[model samples]
Target: MGQAIVVTSGKGGVGKTTTSANLGTALALLGHKVCMVDTDIGLRNLDVVMGLENRIVYDLVDVIEGRCRLEQALIKDKRFESLYLLPAAQTKDKDDVKPEQVKEIIGRIKQLFDFAIIDCPAGIEQGFRNAISGADRAIVVTTPEKSAVRDADRVIGKLHSEQIEEPKLVVNRIRPNMLKTGDMLSIDDICSVLQIDVIGIIPDDDYVIKASNNGEPIVINPQSKAALAYRNIARRILGDPVPLMSLEEKPGFVERIKKFFKLG
Candidate 1:
């Protein structure tokens, strides 16, 4: 059976949703059968990020409420051979669905896909609980800021309380200049604070925002550093020995970042 992994952040605007989108896309690009679920309910944006919003007819609530079958809610992305999306209900609140119901849907999805990625909501309330219910593992996304790191720590503790032994960390939006100037938290700083294994370190790149706004994930383009970082994270998820990226914003960064990731 395949595994379900939840991409969560206790705080909002830390890139959990973005990370979820990229990871799923990267995995699919790597030839994995991937299913991404948006569990944010009323604030669903995974569809928009995946650029499949226009194709969504059935949603999570529709499947959970028996208004439609799970297959009906699963939107296949023809862009990838086996990438599918199960979007959250736009009109329903987080409380409309229970944890057990979410778990049931994900359990069935996991059997069909190589990986089931859960795009969790922003808070540690009913939505968050429901999101984690179906996950076999967790990827906690955070930023290089004091408030984001602090909230990530809380999330790690909460994950342990829920018996998720070790949730991996993805440090998003890393500004290399700020790190070099001691203005931002380093990877060591964040890892020491949270005590979790670092799975990804995404650079703060303008192209990533542009890709999201344009309804295409950056990973599809191998030219951007952020895309390379995300693809590295995906390789790691596949148990590949790709090295952690060195974010050096310089004159020849494109070539240097490729060498760091050992990509052709």
Candidate 2:
């Protein structure tokens, strides 16, 4: 059976949905069948990020409430045949879907793909519990900011309490300039605080905003730095020992030539 993984952030605006979208697309690009489930219910954005929003006919609520079959709610991506999206209900509240129903649907869908990535809603509440109900593993997404890291720490504690231990961390929107200037938390600092394995480090790329605006995942563009990081994370998720991307700014051609000649 396919493993269900939940991408969540205890605090909102930490790129959880973007992580979910890119990771799912990256996995599919790497040749795995992927089903991305948006469990945010009333605040779903995975479909929009994946550029599949206009194609959603039936949603997760429809499948669980018997309004539609599970297959009927799965929207396939033309770019990647292996990639599919199970959009969240636009009209339903978080409390409307029970944890059991979420688990049941995830369990049933696991048989259909290599990986089922669940995009969890922000905050720790009924929606959070429901999103992680059937997940085999969890990916806690956060930024380098103190608030996001603090929230991520609490989320790690909550996940362990819920019997889902060892959730990996993905530090998003890391700025090299900030790190160099001592204005942002370094990976070392964040890891010391959260004490979890760092699975991914996404740089703050302007392309991400452009991609979001155009309803496309950054991962689809291999040239994007954030895309490379997401792809590496997907490879790591598949048990590949992919090294994290270097966050240091690339040397200019002049600097490279100077270094080549052993000059300062």
Candidate 3:
């Protein structure tokens, strides 16, 4: 059976959807048959992020309501042969689908895919519960801010209480310069507070925005540090011993030339 992993955050705007899209794409690139499920319901954006917005004829709700078959609701990715998307209903509210229904849907999909990556809704509400109901593992995305870390702590506790122990952590939007200047929290600080293993550290890169705006995930961009970070995360998910990328910025052409000539 495929592993159903939920990508969640206790707070919104922490790159949960972006992580889901990129990680699913990365996994598919690594030759895994991956299916991404958007459980955000009314505010569904995974379809847009994966550039399948125009292809979403049947959504998760339709599948659960028996309006369509699971295969009919799956939107196949044009870029990746093994990647598929099951989008949430944009017109329906979060309360429209119950937790058991989401679990049943995930259970059905697991039989056909190598991974079921669920993009969970923000906050620890019913939406959150529904997203995690069928998950074998959970990836909690957060920034290195106090509020984000605090919320992650709360969410981790909730996951543990619900028997989803040892949920992995992804520190998103990391600014190395800010960390060097002591302007932002370090990864160590966040990990120390959350007490969970850090699975990924995504750098703050403008390429992420450009890719998302173009309906492309940054993981496909070879030049993007954020992309490399997410790819590492994907490998880690597969139990690979990939080391985390160094958070320092690489020297520019001029700086490299100066260093080589010993003229600095």
Clashing pairs in 3: none
Our tally of clashes for model 3 stands at 0
lDDT string, candidate 1, 1-264, tens digits: 899999998999999888999999999998999999999999999999889999999999999999998999999985997899999999999999999999999999999999999999998999999999989899999999999999999999999999987999999999999999999999999988899999989999898889999889888887899999999999998889888988876658787888878864
The order of the candidates by lDDT, greatest first, is 3, 2, 1
Candidate 1: which stretches are off by over 4 Å? Answer: 253-264
lDDT for each residue of candidate 2 in 25-54, tens digit (9 for 90 to 100): 999999999999999999999988878888
User: How close to the true structure is residue 169 of candidate 3, measured as C-alpha lDDT?
Assistant: 97
248: Cα error in model 2, Å: 1.3
The C-alpha stretches of model 3 lying farther than 4 A from their native spots are: none
- Model 3: per-residue lDDT, tens digit, 1-264? 899999998999999999999999999999999999999999999999888899889999999999999999999998999999999999998998999999999999899999999999999999999999999999999998999999999999999998998899999999999999999999989988899999999999999988998899989999999999999999999999999999888899998998989964
Please report, in order, the local distance difference test score of every candidate based on alpha carbons: 0.93, 0.94, 0.95
Q: List residue ranges in candidate 2 displaced over 4 A.
A: 261-264
Pairs of residues clashing in candidate 1: none
